[model samples]
Target chain A: MIQFTNISKSFDEVKAVRNVSLSIDEGQLFGFIGPDGAGKTTLFRMLNSLLIADEGSIELFGLDPHKDYKKVRQIIGYMPGKFSLYYDLSIEENLNFFATVFGTTIEENYHLIEDIYKQIEPFKKRHAGKLSGGMKQKLALCCALIHKPKLLLLDEPTTGVDAVSRREFWDMLKSLKSKGITIVVSTPYMDEAGMCDSVALMQNGQIHAVESPKAIVDNFQKELLAVKCNDMYKALLTLRNYENCYNVYPFGEYLHYIDKRDSKPIEDINDCLLKHDLQEIEINPVKPDIEDCFIELTRKLSV
Target chain B: MENEQVIIVRDLVKKFGDFTANAGLNFHVDKGEIFGFLGANGAGKTTAMRILCGLSSPTSGLVEVAGYNVKTHAEEVKKRIGYMSQKFSLFEDLTIWENMRFFSTVYGMNKTAFKERGEMLLRKLELFEKRNRLVSTLSLGWKQKLAFTVAILHEPSIVFLDEPTGGVDPITRRQFWEMIYEAADNGITVFVTTHYMDEAEYCNRVTIMVDGRIDALDTPAKLKEKYQVNSMNDVFLALAR
Candidate 1:
């Protein structure tokens, strides 16, 4: 449905988005996961024709985003990360305005956003600024979808809302995809990465990994262990100072340790703990999460 | 008493006219726990956070943060709490050091103490080299890290980070979490609200808020298992469904 060939964008000397080429299929929820300033927004803006790429080709449904922006805009729904709706307008008014922009009426596209709209309908008369962050988000989603574009580009939709709201918003997106709307979303949330059909893990204006979340996790080439001890702080100190420790860092309640290239497996970890006289020892292989993979990838890049 | 929580709010309520943003909310955070406050849009997380940080007044309900009542002793709460807002909460035009100093002064830290703390915090975030640089000049991730540092510069007993990692890189997000651990190790209670479920996994415990109400609150593992989902996002979806 979408194709980009050697898309490279720059703002003066800084290359906000490096030459990137990838193809996205139709009826798919594609996740672009990266930190701020990694050019996620820049790339999205380019796709929507809000900004022109310095060097590259963007084909949306086989039409150029730059040349066919008007036709492209009609087929795409964009929910910006920043609250872009008129803050003074009521929720209904924003929806109506956006619907009118695409030469449609709220009555016409009301069914598309009805699920999300009903949640905020009680506050329909309230000013957007008066709504909570989560409410504003839903309203934005409703307004964006009012036109019912074939492609939806949401920039960090769950960035500021609460956990439940974040969950609810994704639910709405999944429902949208069920209606066969091809969705593209950019988020910094690693947990959200696994929900998508495919994801492109990006860093420093470059893609670190791009594949299904499961495939990426399944491709982990290193053995991982979760180690808990009497003094986790001391254990971390001991582990980081250990001779064969590859990556030793605390993860929530336990410290996650990966052995060096040539280090032994479970026995070696147990032996190290026994030698340190650490109590309540628990050394077991564990699956690495997207965050773990992300941290590992970033560390590799830094090195 | 030693196991007692640092923040305890019962029936926490906030209203804007007839609208009740937070109604009858009850939650607490352990002395040094990284508590995740999850909620959808309009779920009252921000309102509750505002009251906790002394930024806004709760219309009703008993609210306690770091042992301070939100209503009667907001100043005391402010003195002991640090806050990072959802947006560009820092001064866009000011230098990083200036912004930190200004926040220090607002928090009533004296010159000597502010100087020592400011330098230390800046160094911890590796922003010392960019201390004199304008806030606008720094990348979004760098600015957020600096903001998180400034929030805790007073060494407050509790810190509230409201979507502090939004729009930043994954590496920076990991680094931000690292700083949170360092703070927790130093005995500072972290109260945060983020849309990232993976981040929710980092919290000692997480509470899910939907439509101004808490739907689920527990360890990420329990929540994931209960929902029969592999990720926090799915856990949230399962509960919401």
Candidate 2:
């Protein structure tokens, strides 16, 4: 369990996290989703006690992350976004060092990280820097779990990893969650938003929305449409500049647009396209996904 | 020509001294497809990519990237292919426009080519106004977009991007993929890697690597079907477990 009350963090003149307050439940996969400089990492460091917040309080497992940094370190496992593991040490050696630092051994919590360990086991003798992106992730996860902390804090754990390893790593977290461990994973990937039990969509160091991924999507107030035309670029410009459009953004092959007139007649779309000289047009009402929710939320908040 | 493979690797093995980073890897990326190369951390994906980019050598393997043999025609391959490294390594001292210009010159683009492509990319990325700003002053998401634009300055046959959207917001990432798709539509093969499964869904084909070998390779739909999971993330967890 974790709690932050009116927490504000700043680096010199810039405020990273501003007046933030939230709670993360036990045995949950909590995600902090935002763009870079949104203050997710700053919040992570404060919660982990690497950096002290300028104002407010952070409590982890009933202990303050700042004042009780030492004890918090004992009960919480943290994997920083940037590769913070010992690069010079071999995979086994890095794991050993982290375990020793946490006053434990790999064998003690081997079961917690076993799924990840197996992949990096063959390279137990390979230097940490020498390992590939996926292996490094496995090693970091294994090391984090060595102490069997009740809370795990991972900052963008899947950033540069390949898709498969990214998937496998999340699965490892899921299994760990089943064992009743409170996991906190931060990522810029909005799609990963669905995987968490709850998420806080952070922007500009403030909490925008916090809820289950599905709940966020359900909360989307606009009716969405996926549209494609002969020239998507030209079409996007046409759509964005279209009259009374709430939101018009490109999503792969189609432009996911929301109109102020959600229930507008289909004939109106053709009439609008005809005016713009846009041909090969198709529009279908579509369900809003996490990204759509993210964009919609940010747009409304900014307005 | 429509279905021609852009990057073809067979029995690809890459060993750095005693460590075999990539082991007997085999895969093909078709022309104009956005292929997602995936793996867990330490999963040999980067190793295989570096070899195909001609940045590193394969101990023993048969490989072709844009029709050039990686070993014998590395320079030619380098010319025809673009790469965006995982770590954004833009020149901080240079202005955004200057950086693009420098890279264009490095790729041997003529003045006409530079002006034509430069304006096109800047407009496409919405970086036109800030082109005069130093690279260091740009936001992370903007820098990422610019870095990607620079990679394809020469309009390489294939663009290999390694986690090009790290630490950016989801909205920017969505926009970034759209650019990649547009590039693919123009007959430029895209070989990209990412830790996000949703991004993987955008790829024509995806390869998931575990422990220096590919554990699965297929479209996101096929992969989901193969692993009996509704999502690619779940599929990875199943294989990893």
Candidate 3:
């Protein structure tokens, strides 16, 4: 369990975090979803007691993070966004080092990371720096879990990883969650937000919304339209210039279109594209996803 | 002219001692096409891209980029192609204008041409006022957009982008794709790699690599139908599994 009351932090002129107040229940898989410079890292550092907040208070399991820094660190496993491990050391050595630092041995918590560590056990003798990106990630997770911490703080674990590896990493997290560990993760990918039990969408050092992924998507008020045509690029330009067009962006194979009218102007949109000499235009109303909701939230803030 | 092949790779094999990074890759990228290069980690996407960009040599087979054999005319290939990656592209310590000037000079652009084109581009991206600000001062979205603009500043025939929008926001990511679209429309071929499945759908053609081999190659629609999936994410999951 964790709680933050009116948390505000600033570095010189830029406010890294702006009065963010959030709480995570025990055994909940909470996610901090935002892009780089969105204060996810800052919030994590503050919670880990590595960075002091400019104002407000933070409590981890009813214990103040700053006042009880040592105790807080013992119960929390913090994985920074940047890979922070002994690259020169072998995988086994790195895992042992982390376990020793936490006043524990690998045998004491072998069950905690056995599912993940076993995959890289064959290459335990290899240097951490020599391992590939995915291998390094697995090793790092094993290190983070070596102490059997009750809370796991993963900062953008899948930021630079590929799709397949990202999926694999999420599966591992789900398994860890099943073990009754409170997992707090951050990522820039909106698609990953769905995997979390609840997510806080942060942007410009502020939390826009904190709710279940399904609730966020259901809150999308606009009637979104997916438009596909022979020439998507030309169609995007044409749709952007439409009089009632509020926002038009390329979403995979089709352009997601939204208008400023209450009634769905599908015919008018089709006519506009047709007048622009676009062909094979197919416009259909589609459900909004988490990314759409996040974009709408950010746009609302700017407006 | 539109259908002209700008990049041709045939039986391209790259070996690292006992390991074969690229077993045998055979593909051609047409002019003005957005080609997506995708693969799992250690799947040889980087190996093939390095060979195509002339950053590394192939063990065997013929690889040509920008109408020149990369094995022999690596310099010519480098001259006609621009490369940018998510990790490293621009100088963070340097100001926006200085980074642009440095890259332009490396690409052998004249002072007058660099100044005119750089100013125009900065103005278009609405960063002319902040040209003197260091790249580190700007946000990640701004840095990526600037890096992309500078990548195409030299007017390369083909641009190589490796996970260029890795951590960019949703809105800025779409804006970056719009830039790619504009560049391709100007006859500049785009060779990009990304983890976002929705992004793979935007490519004119995509080649998915698996274990140093080309697993599948086709347009998004065709690949979806072939794999009996609704999205590129499913297609990738099916193959990479």
Best by DockQ: 3
Q: Candidates' TM-scores?
A: 0.83, 0.79, 0.97
Off by over 4 Å in 2: A87-96, A99-132, A228-238, A252-254, A264-283, B1-77, B111-129, B155-158, B181-195, B203-241
DockQ of each: 0.43, 0.37, 0.76
**Alpha-carbon lDDT, every model:** 0.83, 0.83, 0.92
lDDT of 2 by residue, B1-241 (tens): 7699988899999898899898899999898888898766667877888888898988998999989999899999999988887585599899989999899888999999899889988987778877899998877877877888898889999998887776677677767877776787788999988665666766778888888888888877688888787677677777765
Worst lDDT run of 10 residues, candidate 2 chain A, spans A262-271
Model 3 clash pairs are: none
Give the candidates in order of TM-score, highest first: 3, 1, 2
Model 3 TM-score (2 dp): 0.97
**lDDT per residue as tens, model 3, B1-241:** 8599999999999999999999989999999999999988888998899899998999999998989999999999999999888889999999999999999999999999999999999999999999999999888899999999999999999999988887778999899999999899889999998767777988989999999999999999999999999889889999998
Q: In model 3, how large is the Cα lDDT of residue A226? A: 96
**Residue A195 CA displacement from its true place in model 2, Å:** 2.6
How well does candidate 2 score on lDDT at residue B117?
85
- Model 1 lDDT per residue over A165-251, tens place: 776678888999999999999987777887899998887678888899998899787888888766566577788888888888767
lDDT of 2 by residue, A1-303 (tens): 689999998777888899999999888899999888999889998988889988898888889887888988888888888767888889888888988888888888888878778877877888899877777888888888889999889999987665666666778888999999999988887877878999999989989988998898899887788887766666776777878777787774567888888586456766787688889889888889887888877777878
Residue A105 CA displacement from its true place in model 3, Å: 2.1
Error of 1 at B7 (Å): 4.1
